[model samples]
Target chain A: MKSLIDFGAVKIYIDCSVKLAERNINHLYPSYVLEDNTVPPDYFVSLKYGGGIRRFVRKQVLFEQDSKSHFKPVPENHAYASFEWGLNYVVSNYAQEFLTIHSGVVANNDKAVIFPAPPGSGKSTLTTYLMGLPGWRLLSDEMALMLPETSYIQPLIKPVCLKNNSIDIAKKWFPDGKFSSIASATAKGDVAHLSPPASSWQQRDRVAKAKAIIFPKYTPNKKMEIYKLDKNQGFMQLAENVINLSLQGERGFNTLTHLIENTEQFEILYSDVNEVKDFIEQDLL
Target chain B: MSKHKISSQQLFDLLADSQNALDLSDSDWVDVIRIFRSESVLARFACQLEESGVITQLPSYATKHLANAKLVAQRQVSSVRFECAEILHIAKNTCEKLYLLKGAAYCLASLPVSKGRTFSDIDLLVTKDVLAQTETSLKLHGWLSEPLSKYDEAYYREWAHEVPPMKHSGRGTVIDLHHNLYLPVSGRAPKVELFLEGAIETDGFHILRPAAMTLHAIIHLMLNDDLKHAFRDLNDLHLMMTEFSKQAFWEDLLDLAHKSGFENELFLACRYCRHFFKTSISTEYLTKLANMQNMNQSEIKLLDRFYALALSPKHYLVKRASANFAELVIITRAHLKKMPIKILLYHTAYKVYRSAVESLLGKAFFEKSNS
Candidate 1:
């Protein structure tokens, strides 16, 4: 089977098992291999070998793998697209010039800010707000691919998954934003993804050079502050956060050293997105 | 060199064709799909194979694994892709070129799309000369290395196969920086530069070719002091051999081993892979290599037993044997290195004590679970 989707000049062919009717609508041409098993309502998911199976489950679906596979009509125009979109990003990004990072990326002009923080750091919240700014693109809300070699950033324009109270916060913030049906009581607690702004999807493959590495912390009562971290300290912190630094060996070490030496680094403590965005724009821009 | 040793590209093509052509059961088909989709080149190859009528269907399993692999690859590729595009606009931008290694490299060079293999941390290899510089660069971007004891850090810098594993602060990913295929401190230090010189470069990254990589896998299993995960490494070696055997890889195997001072290990690995997976190789050629290495009957028998225990599906007996065998090898090698007699004895006693404690604790835990 052959499926073709045009990402501007790039054509992506997704070889999947089920047909997608919305192919023509979004320029997503899907050539699906017909399968005997029934398609489940919630698409099945699994981790491939060598794709970091340690972090993610090998198989995940709303239902069990052995259970009777059944199809339910996907709610038209939902927040998340087919699972194939996620797969497309994986194939297109791995082993390219980029290093897959577990962080959020949002940019204005070519100047992008990479927010690398642990969970509950409000990185996504900051990213969503940054995307709303004119001329700033939302590269990713969950993962920001850092091209350590060239200090470039790749956009994984997927839905911004919000959890717990952030869901309501996002809905109120972007009243026009679409969202996936809320999946409650997940391992990460109640979760929903803010529909990627249509523009974000259109610029999914846009590469940005990161200007600042901001470690965001959301302490509700803390005053908004953006402190410049020393270059050596920042490099050490960033190295600690990179997914494949060690795997890159000496090159990883060199690449990371060069990246840290050149880029400005900061630690942001703020609950207000507007305050954080303004501070980053003033300091970084 | 025989005509049988295939280039990496040719091997990939063969696997793609085989994946498409085989009339495999669903489970087997899934495995093929997983392999194809985990590596980007493989995925593209599979798609081409499909275009050429080499195989039918994307294989459901391919889609399943691709989803997660895709996510990880996206995270890595997007950053670099962006950097490449925006190079002119950025100031003082130094290119930190990283070569993907192991499964991570396979994702880019071989897998159909990025989603075929679920990856946690992207594994990469760079030259050792730039180790300090690279660590400094990563720190600037909010990544931090895990704190290591001075002794451990010195050990990694001085003699280990790779730098101590580094953890990402934001992503919770681990990166392992390797300077050599095996720990340099080992008694049997193979020629590292020969392997480095023979590395195949792809998409701005360098990687060990199939034969060399296979040998590295063997050395990793045998020499590493850490035995807790020996079986997992053994499984990886088994799977890699099974896949590579389909191609014309014998010549590459022989040439790599002879050049790298690892002819004996190459022979042993081939022998073991064949035993465990029923993989086929040129037996006459392997026997010739074994004879040249002067491997005695006793050594062969011992290696064969070790291989059996390593690959056995039943864990109970195999685990114990594996632990004991690993200890014996380490202790014997220490003695051979001319360590003081008292020090060697102390190390042996320590191993015995640790093994006993672990066994007792393991038994107690198992019993508790059963109860």
Candidate 2:
């Protein structure tokens, strides 16, 4: 059987016969996916049992694009996790309509705050906390899609990917939030996903005006500190962080300049989530 | 080289005639989309269908992908323009004349080949006298040459026609500056000065005139060893012919080729384009070229068979069994024409050693992706 998830900017069709893939789709992506299965998918993804009965004792499953095998086979239990990564691979390569960034985005009052950072920088951890604040919505936890002509960020509305210790932190912060089973010792360390709130999924199509860019770093014992960043420095970081800036070319340059000119830029070092949230609300807003 | 179930021939036929869309099933559209993406011609396919007023007939899903493809193609068009302007600004102080070449020329001149075309490097042609000065000016403007070994540098400087490629430090775009079309060591290398006699100036930049432009495209296709871009090169030739055929382009092209001593390459380009795309040329002109050729009918027939297989789409899905063998033969011929036997052996040895070293150092040393 197949399921379809239309994440506003792109539609993905997930096809799988494995039990683990089915369960994860129902639990982690329920709010964003449509009940109707008729939507024509931009990409067809599949996960099926493989490796024969000898290794099938462990029940390995392979990820496929258009029914052709791709990537190495993983344990069957990780099939659902592999599906999301596969979808990202397709969109990051094919989606030329927007300049995608490796960032997390959360919005308040229809204004978005983009957190562009590296992998171990507590980006997803910050986004998870912001989703709990009043009048706040999660736009995206991994990919920030910025329209090149409009300077607006569209909501991707996928579940947050929490890794290692951050997975436990996410669960403790949002007790009621749903999460998928954790896969241990993977490439990015032990990984799990926290389902986004229903309200964020409800307004997934509402594009947000970009308000501030905060490059955050999690320092263990340091007090909360925030410093204003020069617009040119911000522009350079944004250019380096973008996944598809080359495809956007000159238009991307013009759009990014306009974005930096109008938005507040800052680099913050902190270990406490509450202090960061307070600063965003009382100072930056 | 992942294999696909269906061949690219069907997609090629559909692109050749958009009316054939009526016969494609939904599954066929999937295969066609893959082929177009692999060949980097999806935008061209979409634009052709839209121009024919048949885009409305395409399935909604197919049109969605085409719309995205068009957006990318549009961006590439603008990118080429911006790069050309920047190059002109840098070359203003040092070079006397700069001529745009190949895809950059087609786009800047607003020719037919610019439609839905995507390219990476910008190619420029200048006189041999200004070559050193041009390199110095470019370096002053932050265009740094790639680090090349002693042998490779000598190969480019002493034997190759073009100077070593330089890339802008800030923009990260490559520029290839050429003083001649063929290798200095090649037997078929033409008189480099004749190409400059008739040049067209547009927007304060010079381009090869229509006749020379088409001849250069032919020479590039026939003399080069790389067959990966064979399909795209053939399509470029087809587009160029369709646009230039309006004027006395053929006579001018033949005359230019005769003077440059590149008539054989021009003939091969025309024959292949005609056979593959049904490129329209007057039968009288075809007879004239055929009679002028010193090679007998059997030789031409054999060459046609070789190119027919080699020039067709070489994607994993559409590649014929004989395609690799055909490419090997053509490549050997190209090498033979490029250098004498003694020099060729040394050249091949140096290339192999450099390639092995680059691979061992991992791919980061050599920049690969053109786009």
Candidate 3:
């Protein structure tokens, strides 16, 4: 079935062939994207796979959009995951309206905290946990979309992709939290999507002002330690996490500099969730 | 699904003059945006609307997409220049001459067609002699390539126009270093010097002259089996013909075609350029091409059956039911025209065998395709 999802600035029309893909999407998305014929989508994506003997032997799913496949095929079980990843590629390439950054975005009291971290730095894991906390909403789990020269980050609310050990940690922490079926043995092992609170989806159209930029790194058996970044160092560090700055050019550069100048930049090393929560409530709020 | 009544002719007309978008309904705009984006020519359409000062008249949603597409393409214009400079910095000592090709050439030469052009990666051309030294210099730097398997490597070394793409390790920018226009195999390669004769240096790098570049664009569109960029390539030809057309250009192109032994391709190029864009070409040249290719009216109609479908956007929203069959025919036709029958047969057999393996074991099991 072809469904059109309205994600604030972008509308994605997705058609899935496999039943698992359809089921995953229905469960993972905040609500059913009823067929809306009047509104044309910003992106048209489809998850398709071959059947017959290959279905049983070596099942794989292809993620296609814009009449081309931007990614390699993954196991059929990873159909929904493929769609998520493919959407990222589409936004970064075609939707230059949004200056996309490789970061996790969350907000409280309409103030957004940007977590710009490399892979395995626990960005998603921390984001997944924070989103489940009271009075906080998830703007995005994978990317922060900010219009050029704007301090406000547009909300692209979706399920956070938790991987490997973080998957179990999230499951243990939010026992009642909704999650999609786990896709095992992926490039990022044991991937699953954890849906944010319903309140987050309720305010999907709301844009949050840039409050602070935090770089999170997971250090086991250690308390939270915060290190402030100087404006120049902060500018370079935040700029490194921007995915489409090159495409955004001068305006994107100015936006990042303006953001770094206004916001406090910190690199926090933490293992205790409570310590991080206290710091956020004390300093950020 | 919405019923779309638009056809390939409609698309061609719109691309020929992008101002046609002004009359399009919202549903039609939807089709145009999706198809043009898929065909890698959305920026061209966006450029036309912006230039005509009619961009604001469109709905906000349509304008938003067009504006974004233009921004991306404008970014590439500068990026291409920077990438070209980086390439020269790395390989300048190893080579005496370098010619910018395709998108790089168009951008560096400041041609009209270069505006709103978007490229996947940078493509630059070096002579056959300096090809090795260029590769060695890039290798000493942080460039690496995923080696093709032995079977594919053997054929590539024998017939391919370029070496495997060398990507910079630190920068992650890809450079497709080319030595020839097509297959470098004896008796098949075109006269390289003929193109060089008209080349002009610009911004410390040489690019093919306007006429030569137009012919090369035709050759690229009409010869390559990959019709994925067919619409973009055809639009490129249209823009080039409109900008570079002159009495001398038509003469130089015909002369180059005959001497290069590609008059048949020249005729096809001319006919299709006229068919798609209604581009102005002299009746004299048309008659010359018809006589040169011995192209009967029926043959032209028959060729149009394939090119018309093959050249249209390959999106499900716009594609006809028989588009795949037309595409297959074009690919087969391209192979037959580009190679000898014996080599073509061998190539087909190898491809069939490889596909069978891929079907059973999955693709990328044996080789990570350079693309």
Candidate that would win on TM-score: 3
DockQ metric, candidate 1: 0.02
lDDT of 3 by residue, A183-241 (tens): 77777777898877888887888899888899999999997899998988898989899
Best by DockQ: 3
Look at candidate 2 and give me any clashing residue pairs: none
Candidate numbers, best lDDT first, in rank order: 3, 2, 1
Please state the error at residue A85 of candidate 2 in Å.
Answer: 8.1
Clashing pairs in 3: none
Task: Report i-RMS for every model.
Answer: 16.4, 11.0, 5.0
Candidate 2 accuracy as TM-score: 0.74
DockQ of each: 0.02, 0.15, 0.40
**Candidate 3 falls in which docking quality class?**
acceptable
lDDT of each residue in B1-371, candidate 2, tens digit only: 35345655565566567787777766667667766766677888888888888889888778878877887888778878988888899886677779989989999999978888778688998888888898888889888998987887998888888899999999888899998988878766788767776798987689998888988888888888787778878888988898889647888888888888877777788887787777888778878787666677797888888888888776555678989999988887778878989999998898787767655543223532111
- Model 1, span B1-371: residue lDDT tens: 23232222323224324442444445444333333332333333343454566444545444434333444444455543333222212211333445456656555455332322334454545557665666565556545677876655765676566667766676665666565666555545666665665677665566676666677767655544544434334545655675576445667767777776777666776675555434556678767787767678997787566545443332221134364664556436534442345644755686576667645443122111110
- lDDT by residue for model 1 (A7-81), tens: 321233333322222232233221221221222211223211111221133212211111111222122222123
Rank all candidate structures by their TM-score, best first, as comma-separated numbers.
3, 2, 1
Error of 1 at B355 (Å): 34
Top candidate by lDDT: 3
- Lowest-sum lDDT 10-residue window in model 1 chain B: B362-371
